[model samples]
Target chain A: MARRMLNQDLIEALTDNCAPIRPLPHPAWRALVWFAVSLCYVAIVVAAMGVRPDFVAKISDPQFATELAAAFLTSVVAAAGAFSAGCPARPAWERFAAGFFLLIWMGAFAVGCWRDVDAYGVSGLLSHSDIYCLPTILAISIPAAALILSMVKRGAPIAPFVTIGLAALASTALAEAALRLSFRQDPAVSVCIWQFGSVVLLTGIASLFGRALLHWTRRDALIASFQAHRR
Target chain B: MSELSDTSNDRESRWRALMASAQDGDHAAYRELLSDLFPVLRRFVLRKWPNAHDTEDVVQEILVSIHTVRQTYDRRRPFTPWLMTIAARRVADAARSRYARGANETTVDILPETFDGDGAKSEQETRDDREALRRAMAILPAGQRQAIELIKIQGLSLDEASQVTGKSIGSLKVGIHRAIKAMRQALERNG
Candidate 1:
């Protein structure tokens, strides 16, 4: 009887707490909005950093162009996947929608590395240390990550790890692409190991805080405030 | 089987309508919807985590979660799958947290027999300690005593004790804290 009364009290509190709310837009639509805004910010950052002197030449190269395009597509698709994961009842496959482009992006670098080995007898694969890649990607991704996190908090946090991981992937991948336009780093092996590695590392680290970042804060606040009101 | 499916379909549509109304800030509709969902969610939690310490608590949690994220529910889509998805995720989370809490605890069903073990009390000593504890508890204020009895002896959660005692959860926690301190002081004085 006490348990039932407690539930009844909870129900009454919840009902009193109810307010009209606008349903979230489709995940794909939200992803597009995020991508568009993020792209604009990235463009401004790239322009401010000054495009690499060899950027035009690099863009003209078929392999580099394909790799860059793959990265861009991966970011957009991953953004969609992140939003979809935040919503309940979305297909599980939506969580992996970006994997195809990610593989293609990785494959492009693998092909470059193989070509380097073939052309320069493994010497072409070597490059000077580029520790700067990690920090640069992290800096560029901060705004995108903040934007996506705020947008995603509006949805259900059923799959926080997946959602946050994908959001990280989306932002970091875009940041890496933006870095390619502004920083003239060479050797596909170096790019693959350092730049790509940084993206994965950042995503892994960000995902570890998923539950902390996305939780039932709203529900807890509502319950707390309602109970206080009753008291 | 068809009849069961039909019933489920009927339930789904009705719930969707109720949810839509609830989203419009219709208190009656929201109340009815939650009342309907509670039993179903309780059964769902039971099936998902049969070993759960308290199925109703988990159900209430899921309901709170649903209420929090109700804006994410698109009326254009079917409601059952969305509801079930959240329910399953919350069950998994509850199990994870339970395991985490269990990791810090050591459950002992029976104390091992000891021969003159260090710090082990004799029967007389144990009886004296129990008497001292009883006396300490007796001297505590009514609220403090009730708090210890409900939260410590009875092993009820603060929320549950709050509900039963009609005191706020914050007060219950404060009561428990003060009660323990008073008991410790009383015991020390007796010693």
Candidate 2:
């Protein structure tokens, strides 16, 4: 009888608190939306920073173009994975969709490194210190990160770390791609070590704060509001 | 087996429709959906956490989680997986928290108590001390007793004691000094 009463009370409170909500669009759709917005923002940042002088020439090079395209796809797919992670009961595979693209991106970098090593021995892989890489990528990725964080918060926090990690990956990969278009860094090794390294580092760091970013705020608010209603 | 699958399918379709209505702010549908989910969630929690002491609480938590993230449910998707996913996640979370709590707790047959300092005295000892003090106070002269009461017992300054007793501060101080010496001697003699 007591259990029944408690259940009744909870049900009444929940029903009273119910409000109409528009369900989230498919994760793929949401990912595309995020991609479009972040891409535009990244483009504006690139334009503002002034495109690298060899941008046209770099795009004409198949290796450079392939790496850039792979990075861009990784960003979009990772965004989708992040969104998929936020939704419960989506196929677990959806959360790993970005991994394939991530490998391709990494593979492109590996090939570039091999080419540089073949051309100029071990010395060709060496470049002057680029202290600006980490901070510049971070600055470019901030808006994209914030936008994805906000979008993902609307979904469940069932896989917070994975969701946040993928979201961070998406933003940072896009940012690195944009950075490449605007900044000239010599040697594929330097690009791999500095620019790509920044993305990996930032993504790992951001993911560590996933539980802090995504939590059951709505449930807490509902409980508080219901208690207030009872009072 | 086919009958069981058919029942599962029916349940899945019904729950999906009910959830869709709940998202549209249909209160009755929401209530009915929660009522239906409660028993299933309870069973899920039990299966996931066989020795759970708070099965109902975990079930309620799952329900609350579902309500919180209702918007995340895609109407096109099968409802059972969505609901079960949340249920399983909540049950796992509950298990984790229980383990963490258990790790932090020390199980003892008897509750451990705080230490009593060596300076602390028994009630009988306290009573004896009070009685001895009373006897000592009784042996003092009237002036000395008044001085001792005002200064020592009442915690008044010499100036305040003098004011209250209509005596000079110096005289009050002398009275207190003599009163203490006399009490100490009296207590020693009694011992």
Please, what is the TM-score per model? 0.78, 0.78
Worst 10 residues of 1 chain B by lDDT: B113-122
- Residue-level lDDT of model 2, residues A1-231, one tens digit each, is 012236667777788888999999999999999999999998899899999999888898888998899999999999999999999989899999899988888888889888998999998778667868999889889999999999999999999999999999999999999988988885888898888899999999999999878865333334543543464
Best by the DockQ measure: 1
Each model's C-alpha lDDT? 0.87, 0.85
Candidate 1 per-residue lDDT over residues A120-160, each given as its tens digit: 98798886688889999999999999999999999889888
- 10 residues in a row with least lDDT, candidate 2 chain B: B110-119
Model 2 TM-score on a 0 to 1 scale: 0.78
